[model samples]
Target: MAAASIFAVIIFVAMFLLIVLDKIERHIVTLGCGALTLIVVFGICMRSGKAILGTLAVGDFFKKDFWYQVTESESKGINWATIIFIAGMMIMVEGMAKAGFFRWLCMKIAYMVKCRTIPIFITFMIMSAVLSMFIDSITVIMFLAAVTIELAQLLKFNPVPMILSEIFCANLGGSATMCGDPPNIIVGTSLGFSFFDFLTNTGLIAGICLIVSVVFFYFVFRKEIVTENGAEVDMSKFPNPSEAITNKKDFITSSIIFGMAVILLVSHSATHLTVASIGLFIAVITLISAGKDALSLLKKVDYKTVLFFIGLFIVVGGLEETGILEYIAQFIESISHGNVMLMIAIILWISALASAFVDNIPFAATMVPVIQSLASTSGVDISTLAWALSIGTDIGGSATPIGASANVVGTSVAAKNGYPIGWGKYCAKLAPATIIVLAISTAYIFVRYL
Candidate 1:
């Protein structure tokens, strides 16, 4: 058992390194590693004659303990609710995008700030963050990046700084709400936290980070943000925001469905409906309203991200079955001398640094069980540790371009627009703000929870 557990840990670490290096497609790495884990753990169980099937078994392999273990891991490891919820949200966002809602919103904001270059920058940054609070940050960046690129071209200013600021703010904004980021959803649902709980707990800290990041970007980009005609541009050259809408009917329909989804998400505690169910319900309504375009909109949903998450859940589940996560919890507890504050601080900093390079979904999934174990052994409130992990993973991904989905989307958009932002340049520009926000979060955690 010890040898099998050690092997599982090694496989998991190798997978983590490959993911961080990003040399291959993430979904491929995750799925391949997950398969290897299942094989190794199943072989071990079979060899030990511990693979007995229970009364719930229905197939020929049901008599084998290996199959039972596999079933148990699959059931316990994957948070199907969170996965389905994200899928539904993605579908709805796809419908909205097809309707040009995001583009229209971006154009409206562009029109509002066209005359003031600095205000244009700040307004977009805030807009990116705020939009990400309800929608996915990557989608927010997809639309906002296009507008920022066009506006920069018109103003004859570099778009890199503005886009980078938007990316930073989008991630910060996501940390405020449960539906805002994948990591938040995984952590919140796993811990039974409500949307309002996240709003009350992490929302204020996210708002503070957004403000600080905007100020930071202002100072950094002030000199480079000059307009073509001395800080004021010809607004007539810009297209009207209303003209950006391509399908008014679909736009109205999507907006209504999306709004109802948000309302349901907020009232999920009272309604007794899982967030995933609400998202899926809205998605079905969207497809119906989309009429003949429903298939095309459905095709736009990010199935790759959803699959990657499922693969990660299975991979982490293997570790949990092997007792690797509990071992890590014990190691952390020993190092912290069972001090709750110190343990939380350690979890926060480690999660932040790890998430800066690795995907936070897997990191958060793995940490969820470890934090729960730590809480059980230490007799501290699990909610406090959960919040620390949530903030760390959610906000820490802002340190590098590879840290979060929004960062990757923003960078790709910039590169496609002939403003390729190098990893070193991205880190140099945004790492300080990331660190500052993290420090503020650490203080907030200590004051509010500890």
Candidate 2:
């Protein structure tokens, strides 16, 4: 049994390394490794004749407690609510995109900023952050990156810096709200943290980070952005913001549904409704309003992303089932001597660094229970640990192109448009800003919670 556990751990680590290296398709690696862990571990237990079935256990599957383990594993590993919420939001975002709402918004910003490079960059980054607070960061990146690329091409300016800045801001903005990022949604729902609570706690830090990031980008991209002959481009060539609206009816409908979703999400605590439920309800309403175009909207949802999440849940579930996460938690607690402040710092830094290499969603899911366990044993506030973990994971993903969903989407969009940013280039260009924001987050955590 011990050897089997070790072998499972080795396979899990190898799979994680493959994911971090991004040498293969992530969904394939995750699903394959997850299935292997379950099968191999269950077979080992059955062979050893160590099956312990409780009274409620049933049938051959339950003989070795395999079914029970799977049930428990899924309960901790997979967050169905978060998955459903993301899927619903993807549909809503698609509806809005098809309606030209995002394009209209982008055009409006471009018109407001005109040819002023600094103002244009700042406005776009701020908009990305603001939108990500309500919408998924990846969706925010998709629309924002496209508009930015077009704007950059029109003005004959480099779009890579602008796109990268928006990606970072989008992730930062997501940390401010419960519905902003998948990790935040998972942590909030698991710990019962309210939207307002996130606003007051993590929101403050995220806001500060947004401002700091804007200044950081300004300096980093100053040469590439600030054109000596700024007057060369004619603003008249730009499309009128009003003209960007292709379908007024669809725009209005999407707007109303989106607004209602926001209101419901904000008041989730008072109404006792989960954020996922609100998102799903709004998605349904949008579909009904779309009438015959409903199928088209549904088709726009990112099913691949949803599948990736499902695989991620099972992979992490295997770790929890094997007691590996508990072992990690114990190791951390022992090293920190159960000091709450040190533990907070450790979790923050470790999560930040780990999330920089791997996806934060699965990492957050794995850590939530571990953090909870540590908090319960150390007599620290779970809310505090949750906040630390949330901020860390949210900001850390900015360090690399593969770090977060927004980064991946933004980089891919840019690459498709003939501006391929390599991993080293992305890290060199964005790491400073990410590190600065991370430091600010750490300081804010100590000041606010400690």
Candidate 3:
């Protein structure tokens, strides 16, 4: 490897370690690493007088030449499309949240279940899965956790089992759609896979995983979810679900816009429109519909996360420029000996296991380029590898607490409600179930795709 490539690997590894440690805010670490990537690589190129951003000066920052030189490829750009799409989704979710859509939905589900312990447990898991298909899993789990805790307290059952089940299902279900999980968005957008592509390829497998997860978790938590014999389960204690809706007009408006955006995503191939346009359009429509409260709706967008993607993209772009991704792809090819099945299996299991312990978003971002390089090196089917990676990262995060954003949020919500679940307990209960689902997904991919 060259000196520049080695330095890029060092910076990339440092960024990964910092994120896992989480001592500093992740956005800060990624942004800093991204800046360092450009600076360090530019310095290396300057010393050698090369053209890896070596010729462009400060004045070219705003020129088309800069983007042409820097972001000339899908694997080597800031991916503003992903940023805009995510920001749009976030604002849409916030609009629905402000209108109390999630709360009403939760309360409605609770009412329909009518205090049956098993029904409540299964229904919430299904809800978690379904809701996460469109909205963020973390956001889905956030409101779901609050409602779940209240039901558990009222019913005299342990919330840990129910909460864990919900988190696991959310991760699995989030894999079914392009906007469901951040990694899916990153992969789908980067690879030019449309929404329907995700729905067809991963959605079917994810649905199977959801079923596997639901049954496995029910048996795992069967004893804990039982209510006391003397506990009074009264339906009168719960209020009307419709009462939770704060603004009827906003709820209706947001619902329509959210539906329209999803429809556009699903038809992206036929519409000939980029996902970015659809996302921004939805966001604007949502804000405009909010009337005088448009400014407040604007605040709903998570700028930190948007910025985080920017930094991560730049950092990954540096790796691509330094040719480290190509090196890794070559290494994988040598290891697999040109066997496509072996390559798929290796990527799937390794991705799943690695993602179980760390945040899958950055790992997925880093792997996108390597996977692209692998496609060029080995001539393997791109859809197969993309699905393998999508399932691995999407479902893998459910194995441990820190693996995904949804798990972290769900854990905090449970702990605050006095139903704390330790890391050992969480892994002991969920790791096996997660592995089972991963195994099933592996076989499906190997036979169907490979």
Clashing pairs in 3: none
Writing each residue's lDDT as its tens digit, candidate 3 over 39-89 gives 776465425334334322233335442222222224346766677788988
For residues 118-214, write the lDDT of model 2, one tens digit per residue.
Answer: 7889999999999999998877899889988888888878899999999999999999999898889888866767787898889999998888888
Best model number under lDDT: 3
TM-score (C-alpha, index-matched) for candidate 3: 0.92
Using TM-score as the yardstick, the better of models 2 and 3 is 3
- Better structure of 1 and 3 per TM-score: 3
Candidate 2 lDDT score relative to the true structure: 0.80
Rank all candidate structures by their lDDT, best first, as comma-separated numbers: 3, 1, 2
Q: What's model 3's overall lDDT?
A: 0.83
Pull out the clashing pairs in model 2.
Answer: none
For model 3, state the Cα shift of residue 6 in Å: 2.2
Task: Give lDDT tens digits, candidate 1, residues 135-200.
Answer: 999899999998889888877888888899999999888989888988888887777777878888
Worst-scoring 10-residue span by lDDT in model 1: 66-75
Judged by lDDT relative to the true structure, which candidate is superior, 2 or 3?
Answer: 3
